[model samples]
Target: MLRFFFVLAVVVPWTVGQPVDLEREIREAFNLGGFPSLAVAVVVGDDSPVMEVHGWADRAAGQRATRATQYRIGGLSKVFTATLLVQLRDEGRLGLDDPVSKFLPEGVKLPADPRGARYITLRHLATHSSGLPRNPVSRTERESDPWNGYSVQRLYEGLARTKLAFPTGASGRYSNLGVGLLGHALGRSLDMPFEDALRRKLLAPLGMSSTRIAMSPAQLKSVATPYARQDPSKIVRAWDYGCLAGCGGITSNLPDLRRFVSLNLRAGLSGVEPVRGASLTELHTPQRIWDGWSKATGLVWIVDHTRDAGDIVWHSGGSQGFASWLGFSPRWKIGVIVLTNCGRPVDDVGNRLLRQALKKYRKLSPKFRAMAERLVPHLVATPGDKVKGLFHEDFLKDVPFSVLKNVLSGLAKKHGACSRVLRVDPADRPELANVVFQFADLSLVTGKMGVSEGDPAKIVYLRFGR
Candidate 1:
C-alpha cells in the first residue's frame, strides 16, 4: 500500500472587495457554449479550490453534474504519464537521457531510422520529439473509437513496420505514440501495468482518488454521458485506450482535479512521498525551445508566455465527446481545471477563469500601481531611445529599445491608441502590475509592467500578449 500524507494549508492574503460570481460565470459560459455538462475548479494560492458544475451529467438519466461527476480527460493523461516518468527518474530507477529501448521487454521491436532504434531517449518521448507518428497505422479495421482496439501486441508490431518521421531531437511534434510508449516503458520498469504503476506513484500519494484510466463501480455511477456535437440526445461511448492509455484514457472529477492542481502549485510543499520536489521542478523546466523559442515544451506540459501571467504550463485534452484543459502558474500560485462533456473546446474558458481567479485574489500595492500608471503610457508614446532611458540598465540591455518600440508600435496599430487606464492591479511578482487599458476602439488590453525597487523605480519589463 502506498503511504500518503496531508499537507498543512497555508493561508493566502486575498484582495479586499473583489466581487466575482464564479458560479454564475461558469453557468453562463456553459449555456452560451451549449455544452451538455461542464465542471470547473479554480485554485488561488494554497486554499482549497472553488469548484462549480453546470448542466447535466446524463440528461436521459436526469442526473445533474456536480464537483464529483467524472469525465474522460483525454490527452490530459499524457501529463500524468510524464509525471510518473519524472518520479521514476527521481528514485534513480531510470534516467531521462537513457535510451527508451533499455526499458522495453526482450524481443520487443522499435522502429529504426538510418542510425537505429537507440537514437530515441526517454527525454525525447516525454518532450514529444521522438520522431514517432501520432498514432500507429491500423492493421485491423478501425473502431468507432480509434484507441479501443489498439492492443499492446499491435503496438509493437506497428512500430516494427513504421518509419521515422524525423531524426530524434531534430524537431518537436505532438506524438501520442511516443508518450504511450513512455508510459509502457515506465510500467515495465515497475514490473506492473501502466494504470497500477500510476496509482502507486502518483494518484494514491497525491489524494487524487477519483482519477483513473478505468472507473470504479461507484465512480461509474457519477460518470458524465458525453454528447456528440449538435446532438445532445446521442450519447457517445467512452474510449478504451487498451495499450495507449497514456495518450488519452483517464477519467476524473473536479474535486480530484483540484487536488492534482494543488499538487502542481504546491509541488515542493505537498508532502507526497512518491514525488520528489526536485522531480516537479525538473518537469516544469523548459526541456526544448521549438520554433525559435516562440513556445517551449517541458515534459508533456506546454510552456506559454503571456503578458500578464508570465510562464504558464498547460495542456488540453479531447476524446470522443469530452474536452478538458489544465493549467497552472507556479509564480502566481494559481491553477485551473475545466472539463466539458461535449466535443467543443474549453481551453479558452479555463484560461479566462484562471485570470479571473488571480485578479480576484491579488491585492495591488500602491507603489506598483503608481509605477504602471506613469510608465505604460510613456513607453507607448515615447521614442525608442527615450523609452530605453526609463528602463533599468540590465533590462534595457536584455530587451533592446528597438525591439520594445516595434512591439508597442504593432500593438498601437492593431488596437488603436490607448484612450485611458481602466485599472492597475497586482501581478504574480510584487514588482510588476497589470494595467488594463481602454483602447480608442473601445477594446481592452491588459499589460504587465515591471518596475525596479530603487528610489525612483525604472521599468524592468513590459509584456502584452495572450
Candidate 2:
C-alpha cells in the first residue's frame, strides 16, 4: 500500500472552458499503480507548466515527495546526448553523415563488423541503426550495476569484438552502445568530457538547474529512495552508467524536466542558444520509419501517431530502481513528464494522463442540465422517496433511494449547493452524459446520468464520483 500527499505547484488557468482536474487524475494513477513516490508535470500551450507530487520520497522517514525530489530519468539521457550532437553539427564541427571512426581517440579501434565500420555513420548511431549491440561486452562483477566498471578502454575493446546483428542503416533497432558511442564521439569532437559538453551546450542555456549526470551533496539529500519492484522493503542501489552514462545516467526532478518538455513543445523557440534552429528542426524530424511498431524515429525520440492526439514524440526509460517518461505533442502544444522511484514501469500511467489532457469538454446538453437541476435540488431538500422517482430502474437496482439521498446530502453539507454545470462528456458513453458540477463552495465534482432516447426520455442510470 502506498500513501499519497497532494501538492500542486502551479495551477493551470481555466482556458479550455472546463476545469481539468489533473491533480485528481494523478492521484488516481498513483493509487492504482501503488507507486511509492511519483512526480508529474504538465505544460499546456504558452502557459506556465503545472506540477503535482504524490506519495513518499522516503517512506520510512515519512518525507513527502515534492517537485524538487530527484529521480533517475533512465534513457531520457539519450535525448540530451542526441541534442548535444545536433548542436555540434550546427557548429560545423561535425556532420551526421560522417563516419563515427573519424572522431574516435587515437589508437582506439572500432570492432570489426561483416558490413564494415565505414558503413556506420554518426546518423546511424543517433538513429539506433548503427548495427551496434545494446550493450558492450564487459566483465563487471556487479550484476545490479553492470555498467559501473566499464571504462573507455573496455568500451573500445568491446567494440573490437562486437558483431553487427543487422546490416548497417538497414533498420531501426534500439542500441544503448550505439548512442553511448555517439556521446563519446561528441566529447572527442569538442575535446571535453561528455558531461561538461552537455552542460556547456544544453543545460545552462535552458536554465535547467536540477538536471545532471552527477548530483551534488544538496541534490543527493533530495533524491528519492529507490525501491525494488518485487519487494518494496528492499531498496536498490542506483546503477552507475560509467562510460555509458550517455545511454541512461541522468537524474532529474519535475521542475527541471518541465522546462525540457516546454522547450520541445515550443520547438527551439525557448532560445536554446547552442542548438541552431536548423539543427533543432533536423533533430526532431523523423529520420527512420519503424514498420513493426507503426512509429518513427527522430534523433533519439520515438515519433508516435495517435488517432486522437495526432503526432506525439516521446520516450520512456528505466534504471535499476526508477522509471520515467516524457513526451510532447507539437500539434496540441501539450507536454507531460512522469517520474517514479519504484522499478515497475510507469510509461502507461504517463501515456494515459497525456491522453486525458488532450480530451476536449463541451457544454452539457439542455436535457442533461435540466435533469441535474431537478434531481439535485430534490435530493438535497427531501431525503428518500422524493429523489427515487428521478432515478432509472437500472440505477436503483444497485443504489437504493435512501443510500443515494445520504450520499447527496453528505456532498451538499461538505461542498455546499451545486451551482452550475461546468462541462459534459457525451462521447464517452452513448447512454450516459458525464457532467461536472461546480459547487457554491467553488469545488467541483462529476457525475454520469443515463437517459433513454424515447419520445419522452426518462432516467435509465446514474453514477457519481468517478
Candidate 3:
C-alpha cells in the first residue's frame, strides 16, 4: 500500500539504450556513502570530462567541492615509475627482460629476491614480486615521515639483512621495495634523477599542467584539506615519503588526472610513439592470483577484476592523512577519479560513485548489466531488510486489504510531506509496495536498526537491483 511515486529513469546517454542521469546518481551515491568532500569526473574523451560532480569539498569552511580540486595520487606513483622503465626500454638503453644486476653499480647485489636474484628480471620489479620485505627502512627514520631519506646504500644495507620466501615468477607479493627498484634502475640507466626522467618522458609531453612527480611548495598552499574520514569536519595534514617517493610520491588534482586519463585513452602506454603498438600490456594484464582478486602488473600498474566492472584498469593509494582512487574503463572510454585527504577506507565510496556514473553517462553493454546482477549474491544485506520482514508478519498480514492499503497510503503522505521522494517503485516483495522514506548518510548509521525491523517505519531504504 505504499503510495506510488515516479520511478528513476536510466540516466545514461540515449544511445546507450537506457535513460539515466548519472551526475545526480553519482551525487546521491556520494552522499549516501558519507563522504564529506568528494569530486567526481566522467571523461568522455581524453581532453574533457563529459560529467563532473562535487559536494562539500571542504565542510568546515563551507566550500563547495569542484572538479578542479586536487588530491594525492597514492600508489599511482607506480604508473610513472613503470612508465619510465618502459621508456628506457624503448630508448634501447636496456631491455624489459634485463636483470637488475645489469643496471646496478658494480659490487651492489640485490638480495635473493622471491624471484631468484639472478633469475628475477627488471620486469619482476616492475611487476612487484621482487619479494623484498613489506618496508625495510621505516624503523630508523621518523615514524610520521618514514621514507624520506632511504637510498641505494640503505636498500643494499637492508638486502644484506633481508631474505626471500617465495620462488621468483611462481607467485606475486606486493612490495613497494620492488617497484622502488624500478625507479632506481631508471635513474641508474638514464644518468639523471628518477623524478627528472619522468618530466622529460611522461608528464612533459602529455601536457598535464597540474600533475607532478612531487609536490612543489606553491601547490601545497592551494591544496584542498583532505578529510580524516568522509565527514568533512575532521581535517588533517598528509605525510611525505622521501625514498618511497618512487612508488607513491606524486600528487595530482582532478584537472591533471583528467589530462592524464586523456593521454592514457589515446596512447595506451605507447606514449607518443614510432612504436607501432604496446609491449606494455603486462601492466593491465593479470599476473597472479589473490583469493577473490586477481593481480596483474603492467609496468607498475596494479590490475584487478570484479563481476560487473569489466577489466577495471584502476588503482587507489593511501598515505597517512590522505587516500585516493583513480580508474577507468578502456572499453567504455570512461574514467572516474576520486580524491580524499583522509587516510582510511574510501574504496566503497569510490566504487558507488563509479557505478552511478557508468549507469547514466555512457552506453553500457548487456555485459555490464549481467556483471552487476552477478554482484548481488556477493553483497551482505544491511539491517534495512527487516522492515519487510516485520511488515509481512505484523503490519501487513492482519489489516484488511483496503484499510491496510489506506494506512500505508496515509503513512506515505506523512513521510512525503516531511522529505522529498526522489523516486518510488515496486521492490522485490509485492506485499507492501508503498514504502516511502528519506535518505541519510550511511556513515552516520553505524549499526542502527531500521524502524521497520521493529522500531517503526521512519528509516529509509532504496531500491537497487537486477
Candidate 4:
C-alpha cells in the first residue's frame, strides 16, 4: 500500500454540513463483518451515551440484538478482577507487591523457579508478567469446551507440574492462568468465591446486576446465542470458567459496559465505594513497557498512544464464540464499547469509531485553525521546492523531498486542487498539528505535521493517511 499520503475519498465525506455519523460507520462494519450480531455504545464527554445494535441475537430463533442483549466480554473480566485487587490493596487488606504464595489456597502452590528462587507477586499476575503459560492444560484436553470441566483441584494438580516460561518480571507474556490464579487467591483471602467477592466489592456497588459469570435463567434468555466463527450456523455453548472465571468468564451488555467506561473516565468523581481515584489510576498506569513504549500493560488495561487521539486505555477480549473491545480516552472523556456474538475480532471497528469520536468531540482553537489554513495551499498545489522549505532539515533527511513530492503529485493527479479544510486537531504541544482537507473533487485526506523544536514554523515531521 502507499504508506506516505493516502486518499479517503470513498470512506469519509468532504461535503460541508454533513457530520461524520458513527452509527452509519458501525453499521457498515457490521455488514462487512458478517457476524451473527453486534452492539455498540459510545460516550462523548458528559453527553448521554448513544447505543446501537445490528443483526440478530439468536439468528436461528429470529431474535434481533438489542440494547439489553448480553454477550460474553471474554478477557475483559481480568480488568474487574485486577480492580478488586487494587481495592483490597487500598483497604490495607493486601499489598500489590505481596507474594502470590501468601494468598494461595492452603494446599495449592504455583510452580517455583527451579533454576533459582523467584517470588511472583500479585502485581506480576495482574500484569501478565508472572512467567506462567497462557493456559493450565493442553488444547487436546479442553477441545471446544475449554474451561467447563476444569475444577479447582485440577488446576492445582496442573500447577504442581508446571514450569515457568521465564523468571518473574524478566519480561511480559500474556497468561490467562496467571490472572485466574490471582482471582483464586483473592477469593481465598476474602473467604468467599471470586464471583461473590467481585459482586459485593464492585458490580453491585456500580449497579451492574446484569454482569456476572453465570447468568440466572431470566438473564440467560437475554444472552445473544454464541456461534462458531467459521460457521455461524453452528451453535457454540457459553463458556463456564469454573475456577478460572477471573480470566474470561463474564457476560455483560452495552448499558452495563457504558456505565463501567463512564466510571473509569470519572475515576475520582464516582462517589461509589471501592472505586477510588487512586485505585483506578493504578489500574491504568503502565507497569511494563512493550513495543518500544508506544504500548504498555497496566494491571489488566492496555495503554496505547496515537498521534490522532493521544493516549488510549483499552482492552480487547475473545472467547470460543464471542469478541469484545472497550476503549477510552481519559483526556478526551470519550469511550467506545463493541460486542459481537461471534469470535471474530471487532477491534478494528471499535478503533475506527474511537477515531471518529475523537475528531467530533475535539474543538480546534483559532490559532490552530489558522495554522491549518496557512499550510493547505502549499500542501495541495505547491511544487517540490516550495513544500521542501516548509519542513525542517531533520525531517527531509528521513523522508527525502523526492519521496514527498511524488506522493503529493499522485494525490493532485487523482483528486485535483484542494477546496477547504474540514478539521484541525492540535496536539498537546502547540507546534504539532493534524488537518483533514477536502479537495476540489470533494475527496477527503488527513495530513499531519510537526514543527522543529528550534524553529516552530518549519516542519520536522509529516504524515498523510486515509
The RMSD of every model to the true structure, in order and in angstroms, is 10.7, 14.0, 15.0, 8.1
TM-score of model 1 (CA atoms): 0.76
lDDT of each model, Cα atoms only? 0.77, 0.75, 0.57, 0.79
Better of 1 and 2 by TM-score: 1
Q: Put down candidate 3 lDDT per residue, 1-466, tens digits, no spaces.
A: 3432222211121121356666666667566656666666666566454445466656667777666666676677787777677667878888877888787777765566433545668887777666665566433656445665566577777756766656666566777777776777778788887777777777777666677656668876456676665444667656555555677777777777777765555545544342213644444566555556654555666565654445667777877556777776555556777776567556665666666555545452233223222222222222223233323233334343344334333333332221332222222232212222232221110111112322323222222111
Backbone clash count, each prediction separately? 0, 2, 22, 0
Deviation in angstroms for 102 in model 1? 1.1
The list of candidate 3 runs beyond 4 A from truth reads: 1-18, 34-36, 50-65, 113-119, 137-143, 149-152, 226-235, 267-282, 289-295, 305-309, 361-466
TM-score of 2: 0.71
TM-scores, all candidates, are 0.76, 0.71, 0.66, 0.76
Best by lDDT: 4
Q: State residue 73's C-alpha deviation in candidate 2, in Å.
A: 0.6
lDDT of 3: 0.57
- Compose the digit string of candidate 2's lDDT tens values, residues 16-88: 4556677788999898888898789887754544588999888898999998899998888899888888788
Give per-residue CA lDDT, model 1, range 399-465, as digits (tens): 6567667666665666666667677777665556667766666667767667667687776666664
Query: What digit string (tens of lDDT, one per residue) describes model 4 on residues 1-466?
Result: 1123223232244344458788788889888988888898887654535689999999878999999899999998899999899888878889998998898766766776755337889999999888989988632245678777458888888888788898877788999999988998898889898999999988898888889886678778998999988887678876777878899998999988887887788755546455787678778888998977899999989999776567789999998889999999876778999999998899998898988877666654455455556656654544547666666666666776777777666666678766777877656544456678777787788776554444355655556763
TM-score of 3: 0.66
Model 3: per-residue Cα lDDT at residue 393: 39
lDDT of 3 at 306: 52
